[model samples]
Target: MATPEAPLREILKSVSFTQFPLRVIEPFFVADKIVKPRLYIYPSFAVHKETMANDEKRPMLPTFDVKSLYMLTALKFAKYDFDIAYTSEPDASPDGSLPFLLLRDGTALDFKAIMSKLQQNSTELGCATEEQPDYISDVDGDLEMPKNELPSEPVYRTMVENNLLPVIEYLTWTDPVGRECIGEGKYLGSYPQIIRNMLSWIAATDTAHKLKLGLPEYGADAMVLDGEVLYENAFRTLDSLLVLLHTVDDSRLFLAGAPSLLDALVFACVNVFLYAPVKSPVRTALLKSDSTYKPVLEYAVRIFDQYFASA
Candidate 1:
């Protein structure tokens, strides 16, 4: 029952590439040509970063679903090589649109079918979980508890007492079901040392990578951008993210310990600088043989070992 105009509008809104500037958009437009079969592509947080940098009027947090789609589109485009036109001048077409070609030999391709396949592939790649009998048992036991008396709060408080607020907060915020499990005075301390090991690895890798890129280091207590006090009044956002992850009762509820929106955000923010061709001296220092990140690398290895062992 859908008309051509309605479907076109829907596709445009769903892709949402226009939210970004020309620099980020150019890569995607070029990639789209190589993808073939004429599928609509979206942008990722990397593209969003450019928008945030170039347009002062852009929203702080654009829709996550839209961004996710855009990332997927970019990934697909990365698989191919194609020439594309890049321009800062706004499109002056009927709907102010950028033109793209569809790879069809006088036959309309099934966009819906292609999208479904891509979604399935993406989920499979992102959620490569191993079987954890013991962890599964523990999770089952927790789920069986009475609704009014889950043990999340007490455990959360324990984490707070042990100076584990960052991990706890990260878990709680990232886990969709955490809002229900979190209670006053409750801290997250039930997770094994392996989880802590993973946190250490993440923090260490992030720090080392940032230094290698000659970017400003992120302090545990504050956020400093280019040595200027951008967010003077706010607490360290990364710390908060880690706390939410640690405090949440169900670590696997949202994306279930796999790469979700949070992981994507963290990866893009921390690792994007590495994609550049030239390395910075600061980055060199962080990645040196005698670097401080040796402990973090070890921790990551330990966490991965635990994960595999428990599988």
Candidate 2:
């Protein structure tokens, strides 16, 4: 009997980096049984080196080696790779331009080892330096804002109770819209819609319209009434949701507990709201409501501190 010709090798090839989005890539590599090799082009290698030089104290901003960051972050919980399958032909100045080879053999690689390799590679390329950015000081300085100066608590609670929870539930539930809204894009629908609705409710100055829509009037508070109520509501709601999601130990409260898909889903939603450009009523409302939402903001900060802060 003739020996089979090695059952014809199957190669999985993709042009994108394995760590384009760390969160998304984490699970895919974890679960993949077959070859899922990715070819990452270090297009921002020079820019990344500059960013690292600017931020001296912190680990270099790994723009070119984002795959390494993903691996490091994942290694906080799992393991992943370092075996070099191949390296591209060296050009005249291949220092930052050459693409490094990576192979996935379905083995759990050491995170520290991979990080060390990346650092070593950077050093060999003469890119290592130490000059921390001024932005770091700015961030550190803002942390001292006193409690009394922060936003109020009641307004924060109202936001959570009224807006964030409903939006999260609507997104996660498998009802009419939920069924069709599968995959990563599902979370987008509810947040934008809710923000739009809240803006509409706030913009309607007519007492009758406010009453019909079940929106409360700001009474004689000219500042809040002017336009700040909407953003106050949004920030408060967002903070509450972050607190609830981050603190609650109950798996039932979210689609899954820590390390589940829900964590990513909710984190993305809350983060977008946090960073989104505020406009009109929302911007005005947030400015006035900031004092009232202090506790909630602190709670949000604390949660982030607990999870993301280095010990």
Candidate 3:
């Protein structure tokens, strides 16, 4: 008798529990591929306004922002091609944060994720031009430094994020002068006055909570922030940064021979301290004659003039 034919369902079932595909597609997640990227940054103040002799108006100076400036610098340093769209709403991002990057394939990456993606150096990410070199040089051998050596780039980065960032927040949200300079109109300029005021109050409340200021205290109140402790920590952090800056060879623009992430961060912090319209004692300290922070002040100016001044 002819071999009994199996049921059609049985024939269609796999003979083996595991079967490998005959060919592998190059990229499994085609959606993750990046073409040109777009960066969404908070708008900066138009700090400088000038009228030309010919009755034409000159472009206003772009002010520095702690978050936006660093992200911008990092992308620029990577030689990445991108378009910048300024928005006041953080909720526009995938995770409700400002400074998120949008890849052409609709991928939204936060700051940490963006840095991680850049480090992957994937060709599909389109971070570099076809004709340009793909590798970014690490000027200092910090990556491979001995454990006991001066603090590495990672260490410095942590110090800035943890220590310096809070000070900036304190200044912007809790200081009277800073609040005035960063008026509600800066971000919510398009909204109606009533809505703007309401949103501003909500934002202030949220900031107060985040900054750990006690409830029932708001807007430049003594309970909002401890100026003594804040400035003390800032001074210590600045001193550490000054020491790090001194380690860089006089010839290089950044800690790394090339512009590294740390350079981006340092530039952002110092630039803001120097030129952001806020009345910060740190700015006074940096600019004072015979200031201990001369290198930092100079570094900020140099980076701005070289990279961001004309932008």
Candidate 4:
């Protein structure tokens, strides 16, 4: 698979890791039944957790969105390895989105499709559900058996609507300070000033449009008064999720003990909330460790360490 001229890394502050932008790369296709996907993700940033980072060193940030986190984590659980490429223009994707999977069959799968593909191909690909790992048993292990099976769609709906979507929109679009950093590449850190500002506008407008559709409460007209409330809702939702995790005999650590799409969504939203590109009151609450959201902050760190693989 040959790549077009990738964006120069020398000017990119010498990224510790790099991914080929899809616009600049043509993926490989083969007749081989066994295939490894080429994963396209949002740009990688630096992970600096004042409360979460106990060590002196910081590691490169992984996939930027929750779905990407989920997809990568799900692949890890399925025991599949993939080639990764990062690009700021997820809009250029066939589906016009981020966190997509390009397979050897020349198939492009978005988040849900990626999950379906994993579960469908697990047997041929040799996943834990088919041919057990050295650990993570199928039927006998005490540890939660890691599989790619999905959770309830309603759970997905509730989380995204009340928890993830609003908060992401609030932070990325409605807030002015956050907008400045995004436009300036303080978060993505890969584009020219004009391109960065353009990407920021696209992301903000698209998310804001989604919020507008679910309007009245989230209407664009209400952005000034109600937008900040989205952060509060996100924090409370985190605490609620914590309660759900504690109360239910759900899967260990994650919603189902194994890495699934649901956890990916939750992790993406909460992770970005605590470590937004620009600091705000919501971030302050999580950072204080005295606030009610301290446990949720801790949970974010636990998942990051477990899945993101800190260097």
Candidate 2's C-alpha runs over 4 A off are: 1-257, 277-303, 306-311
lDDT of 4 by residue, 181-250 (tens): 5434544456777777786878777876876533576465576656656666666676767676665433
User: Whose lDDT is higher: candidate 2's or candidate 3's?
Assistant: 3
Pairs of colliding residues, candidate 3: 139-257
For model 2, how does the per-residue alpha-carbon lDDT over 233-286 read when each residue is reduced to its tens digit?
556655555455455532232222323222322333342223222122222332
TM-score of each prediction: 0.24, 0.23, 0.70, 0.65
Report the lDDT tens digits of candidate 1 across residue range 1-311: 55576666778778868667655433444432232233222111222232233233422221122222233323222232222322222233223322231332323223332333333332221211244222211222211111123234334333332332222222222222321222111122234557644644454445435433224445453222321221111124334434554554323322114323233333222222222112322223224578543332232233323322232
For residue 291, give model 4's deviation from the true position in Å.
3.2
Top-TM-score structure, candidate number = 3
Each model's lDDT: 0.30, 0.32, 0.65, 0.59
**lDDT comparing candidate 4 with the true structure:** 0.59
Error of 4 at 31 (Å): 17
Off by over 4 Å in 4: 1-35, 47-58, 116-157, 183-203, 213-221, 248-252
Off by over 4 Å in 1: 1-70, 73-227, 231-235, 244-256, 277-311
- Model 1, position 154: C-alpha lDDT score: 37
Q: By TM-score, how accurate is candidate 3?
A: 0.70
**Which scores greater on TM-score, model 1 or model 2?**
1
